[model samples]
Target: MRSWKRRGPTYCKDTWGCPRSQRKRVVFNKFGQPIGKIGKKFTNFLGTVARLGAELPIDQFDWRQVPNEKKEDAWEVVQDYYDVDEMHKSWTLSNIGTKWKDWKCYLRKTYFDPGFPCTDDRVIGDQWTGLYAHWQSSLAQKHSITNKANRSKQVMMHTNGTQSFACKRYDLEKGSGKVLSRPELFKLTHTKKNGKIVDKA
Candidate 1:
């Protein structure tokens, strides 16, 4: 039996629930990168799809400018690794675009920054060698610094630690059996795991 899952955008094809046993699994290396195609985590598979399929300037390319053909191509690739149906194509396309943007930000923070162990090109391995050049470009550096400065000016920062906002919203909705309001989501996101408010002022 087919049923809609109330947890965020997870669409379950089962009547009981979308258990982990039903979903695709992914194998990861020590660096957390996917090792293969099918049976992988959705986000990692999507990340791999973006890295392999999309071709754009790493520094300042916009998703809006990406051709529909490219997105369609990406969608087809995702279908090979995920259980997503054709009915979910629109959502999957948008999700892919968002994931692509997030991947660029992550690459900048991980490879361009000073602290991470994966910052060095000599040991970054062949998979990331293509991105190493782009991250080293002056344009990428400018954008990274500008984005960092802008982020520092934001007052209401979420205290969810490693938990993503989507996951948090999904969990909250699953427990409550209803969609969360914008205000409720904001409050929950700003609250820490210890039940303390993140920004009291």
Candidate 2:
């Protein structure tokens, strides 16, 4: 397993907030791109109403809004506000607070065990990859980091003053995966056209 994870960017210049991370996510994807780089910053809730009418021109009488048609350009304001806006609003609202993981998990790419010369010529890598961890694994449990500095490192805190890292990893394996749910697995097996797999598990 890798010993350390590269922390998030110190600045927003590298990858803009929420878009890159939530691009694959539904709620933010529907949000229209920020006008003049001022994303989702509406002048007011009524302003949002005005913009939606101006953009979609949905007639109250006809009520002809279609599915997935406006998905990419849907308004976050609309989605978060009206119950009719989101497809899964009920589910989202139901899980307002919950504990997810119970232990920390790490990953490292290597050809041999610890203390071995990594470049040993005999060493080789394999494909068909997945992580190996038991049922209760997390990258952020037990550690108490309520201090401001640790929170700056993306540490999550509870009301009880305990802390945990906010990091996450994909259990690419198919079955018996912890936190397995509706989301697809992050599996990368074969190399692309000319890419090489230096190491894999």
Candidate 3:
């Protein structure tokens, strides 16, 4: 049998008992929910699909590995994260308030949400080193860029009881070449301006 699921945009709270994530979604990594591509058939004559018995938890993803050649071509966006001190705290499930968990969830939104790959480059330094450590460092870098830009912006409320947040981007004609330097980055959000469009570049 097919498991129950919400098909539409998840942030909806309709009167028909649909669930909503309120402001948005908070990623869950504590548990794994088994999911399968196929369900049952109309009759035993057609053979029924079996339910998947296992699933890897959200945190099982390996960060140090990525498709080498493919990573350069898929080039997308510079995933961003928030650098808060709490992210360094203990993330064991026993800690009802886990900073590490919070940080991981937020970072994931930037990666997969922006169509970026899940793999990350391993950091080489005296700080911390390991699967989790690499992510912590990279996410910190992303967080700084986004946080700085956010702090520099101003939001205004309109007199008509409306509010909007818009920032102008200059240098729409700037051009830059591509390199595969590990630190430089292959994926980054598009900054195209002046109504220009790029089909494939």
For model 2, residues 33-78, the per-residue Cα lDDT tens digits are 1111122231122232322432323221112332333323344433
Prediction RMSDs, each to the true structure: 12.1, 22.2, 21.7
User: How would you encode candidate 1's per-residue C-alpha lDDT over 1-201 as one tens digit per residue?
Assistant: 998765322222231234434555443333333333332245534655555433433333668877777777887666555556565567557766776787666665665576354543322354355556666779867977898899899987888664545666666776889988878999988987789887876
> Tens-digit lDDT track for model 3 on 1-201?
998975322211121132232221122221321111110001110110000001111232232232333222211100011111222122211121122233345545656447555443321222122323445577756875796698677443122111101100011111343323322221122212443322334
Ranking by TM-score: 1, 3, 2
Pairs with steric clashes in candidate 1: 25-39, 25-40, 26-40
What C-alpha lDDT do the candidate models reach, one value each? 0.59, 0.26, 0.25
* Best candidate (score: TM-score): 1
Lowest lDDT 10-residue stretch of candidate 2: 96-105
* Ranking, lDDT, top scorer first: 1, 2, 3
Q: Which of 1 and 2 is ahead in TM-score?
A: 1
Best by lDDT: 1
